[model samples]
Target: MKTFNYHSAKDVKEASKLASSSSAFLAGGMTTIPSMKLGLATYKNIIDIKGIKKLSGIKVSGKAVTIGATTKHAEVANSKEIKKAIPSLAALAEGIGDPQVRNRGTIGGSIANNDPAADYPSACIALNAVIHTNSRKIDAEKFFKGMFETVLKSGEIIEAIEFQVPQKSNYQKFPNPASRYAIVGVYVAKHKNGINVAVTGAKSCVYNDKDLAKTLSSNFSAASINNVRVSSSGMNSDIHASAEYRANMVKVFAKKAVEAC
Candidate 1:
């Protein structure tokens, strides 16, 4: 790994100021540290924001659950408030990687890294969550760009994520045994107005399907998605699973999610 200067930011403003074109913000360092060690990423400045107290915790108001960016996956998984308000999210958190990774990984880091197989983006998009940055609030639909990417600008810090609680929701993931990353994961959320379905792993980015949403919103049943054919095009084809296999799993998991909900 390349040697780099380190700066500990006392607050979000300081962290933002410390970041530069060649700098990287250190949250849990789950993804960042590994990349650095692999020589895939090197930064002249490492702005550690984990010490910022304001960026850690879970808050709930009305029907919304807002989670601070630096909040650990373990914290979210065990949070009673999160469990009561959005149990599916807590379940998703608990299912990430393993005990050590869960204890060390942060929600902000996960979403920021935007791993195509990561679980949080599925929840974020399905819940219609709002990503609060240091400067602006980005809707989940607009936040994710593609694999390992997002709309986050250079130096911009994700502060927290606020999820609009649904009437009922559930998550189902077909995980890869070794990595515990999803080969295909689906999050289904039913709201007063309609339903939202967010899929991950099968695609380059977490995505929502309006057709599936419309069909399920009206029927609210597993059978509703039976006729909704899942296409293999644009899916991620890997050693773990083929695009066609993933496409089939998308439908299968969607049914499972709906049943669970």
Candidate 2:
């Protein structure tokens, strides 16, 4: 890694104020450190946010489950509150990468990085999450811009993520064996308002499958979307799987998620 000034920020204000155009807030450093070592990215300053006590915890209310930004994947995976309130979320956390990554990676880093194949983004979408930042709160639907992109400003820092509690929800993913990153993942959530079918790992970004959601909202069953065809257009195609195959897996995983729910 290249030389950079590292600052261990004590609070949100300090972290945000320290950020510059070439600065990055360090949480888990799962992606940031790797990218730097690989020469894919470089930062002039690394503002460590992990030291901020306010940025790590889990809060479960009757209406929502709010997770602090720096909460580790392993913490979420093992949290009794998370398991009792949103088991699907805990399951998703358990499925992220390996034990080391799970212990080191964080919810904020995962969502902020916005990796297309990431598991957390699908849960955020399906659970109707609101990203709480230093500046403002953003809806999960509106937060994500595109591939590896979010609406987070240069100096802004995510504080927490609040997910609306659903009546029933489940997540299913076809993971790439080597990396455990989803090749196709689906999260099905049935709320009082309606059903949400969030799909990831098949496109340039995670998105809600309107057709699947509409069909499932009407019936709320695995068989309800059996005949619904997911189009291959705008899907990712690579060595692991073809665009058509990934598109097909989207439906498959959606059905699995609904059945699990």
Candidate 3:
């Protein structure tokens, strides 16, 4: 691994100042550290945000549930507030990579990284969660642009994610055998606006299944998805699975989530 200077910031302001150039912010370091070590990423400095107290915890209000950025996946999975407000989110967090990954992978890192196959982004999109940054809050619908890309600006750190309490929600994933990253993951939720279906791992970015969403919005039931045809036109293709296979999985998961809800 290449050598680098390390600094532990006292707060968001200090952390942001250090994150300008050739620097990476460390929350859980579940992915960042490994990428850096493999030379997939290079950094002159590593800013540890773990010491910043504000970036950790779970708080649930009548309006919404706010999860601090540095809070680990394991913590989210075990949070009583989350389990009570939206149990599917906890179940989804519990299903991420493995025990080690869940214990160290923070929701903020996972969503900010916007990994094509990661689970949290699906939940964020489906729930219409608001991503709070040091600078300002961005809606989930506007936050994600593409793979590993977000609207988050330079020196801006994710402070927390606020999820609007949904009427019903469910998440389903077909995980790769060893790595446990989803081959295809889908999150479905019924909100004030409508039913939203966010599919992950099928492509380089999470996409809303408007057809399924419309169907579910009309009738929140598994039978409603029977006539829907999931398209394979823009899905990912590789040795692990074909674009058609991922498309098929999306339909299956949508049905499963409806049944689950």
Error of 3 at 17 (Å): 0.8
Cα lDDT tens digits, model 1, 44-83, are 9999999999999899877899999999999999999999
Per-residue lDDT of 1-261 in model 3, one digit per residue for the tens?
889899999999999998877888888898998898889998888999988999999999876889999999999999988999999999999999889998898999998899999999999999999999999989999999998999988799999999988999999999999988889998999987788999999998988889999988888889888888988999999989999999999999888998998
Better of 2 and 3 by lDDT: 2
lDDT-based ranking: 2, 1, 3
Give the winner by TM-score. Answer: 2
Pairs in clash, predicted candidate 1: none
Candidate 3 lDDT at 14 equals 91
Worst 10 residues of 2 by lDDT: 217-226
TM-score of 3: 0.98
Query: Which sections of candidate 3 miss by over 4 Å?
Result: none
Tens-place lDDT digits, model 2, residues 196-220: 9999999999999999999997788
